[model samples]
Target: MTPFLTGLGASLGLIVAIGAQNAFVLRQGIKREGVLPVVLVCLASDAILIFAGVAGIGALIQSAPALLVVIRWVGAAFLVTYAAFAAKRALRPGILEAATAPRGMTAWTAVLTAAGITWLNPHVYLDTLVLLGSLANAQGSPGKWLFGIGAATGSALWFPLIGFGARGLRGFFARPASWRILDGCVAVLMLGLAVVLAAEA
Candidate 1:
C-alpha cells in the first residue's frame, strides 16, 4: 500500500502538467463538442500506456534510442503543426465563439482526435508509462499493478475534472475573445512543449 501510494503520487506528478491533450480536452469540454467521447478516449489512451508501462516495457523502450529519437522528431513535428493550426484558429473570426454554434465535428471524429492526440504525444509515454513502469519495477510484485492503477486513475481523475471544468466555464468564456485566448494559449503551449521535448530528446 505504501508503494502504491508512492506510485500514485508519481503518476499525478507526471500528469499534472500543461500539455496539448489536456488543452484540447479542456477546449472540447468547454465547447461541448462531444465531451464524453473525448474524455473516454483520453482515459482509454492513458490506460493503455500505463498498462504497457507496468508490464516493464519502459526499460526496453528506453534502450531503443533510435525509436525514441524518431518519436521525438515526430512529436516535435506534430506539435509545431498543431501549434500552427491553433494559431490559425485563433485568428479566425468565429473559432472561439463557435461553441454557441453547431459543433464542427462528429462524435467519432472527436473520439479519434482525442485518442490520437493522447497517443501521439511523446511526453505521455515518457512521463506516465516509461517513468511509472520503471518506478513500479523498483517496487516489484503487486506494486506494478498499483502503479498502473495509479497512473490510470490519474488520467481518469484529470480528464473528467478538466472536461467538467471547461463546461462550467462555457457560460463565461463564450465570447469570441475567449476562443482567441484559448487557441492562442494552445499555440504557445504546443510550441513550448515541442521545444522542450526536442531539447530533452
Candidate 2:
C-alpha cells in the first residue's frame, strides 16, 4: 500500500504538468473528437512505459548513451515539426474556431496526432523510463511492481479526467481567439522542449 500510494502521488505530480501529451489530449477533448481513443492511447502508453521502467529497462537505457542520444535527436526533430504546425495554426486560428472549423478532426488523424505527441517526446522517456524507474526500483524488488502499478493507475485516472474535464470548457472555446491562444502556448511549449532536447543531444 505504501509503495502504491507513493507511486500514485509521484506519477500524478509528474503528469499534471502541461506537456505536449496533456495539451494534445485537452485539445481533442475540447473538439469533442476522438477523445476516447486519445485517452486510451495515452493511458496504454503510460502503462507500458511505467511497467518497462519497473522491469529495469531504465538500466538498459542508462547503459546505452548512444541510444539516448538517438532518441534525443529524433524527439527534438519531431517536436520542432509539431511546433511549426502549431505556429501555423496559431497564425490562422479562425480556421479551427468551434463555430467555423470543419466538424472536428477525423478519427484517424486525431489518433495519429495523439500518438505522435505521446511517443515522439523524449521527456516521456526521461520521466517514465528513468525517473519513475529509479524511484520504483528504490522501493526494492518486492515493492517496485506495486509502485509501478500505482503509477499505471495514476495514468489511467488522469487521462480520462483531463479529457472529459476539458469538455466542460467548450463554451469558453467558442471564440477563434481562444484557439489561437491555445495553439500559441502549445507552439511555445513544443519549441522550448525541442531546444532543450537538442542542447542535451
lDDT of 2 by residue, 8-65 (tens): 9999999999988998898889888889999999999999999999999988888898
Q: Write the per-residue lDDT of candidate 1 for residues 1-201, one digit (tens) a residue.
A: 777678668877876776788888888888788898899988888888788888877888888888877787788888888888788878877654453477666789878778767776777878766788888777788877886787688788888999887878877776778778888899999899889779967
Each model's Cα RMSD: 1.9, 1.7
lDDT of 2: 0.88
Task: Rate residue 168 of model 2 by lDDT.
Answer: 92
In angstroms, what RMSD does candidate 1 have relative to the true structure? 1.9
- Please give the TM-score that candidate 2 achieves against the real structure: 0.94
TM-score of each: 0.90, 0.94
Cα displacement (angstroms), candidate 2, residue 36, comes to 0.4
Query: In candidate 1, where is summed lDDT lowest over 10 consecutive residues?
Result: 95-104
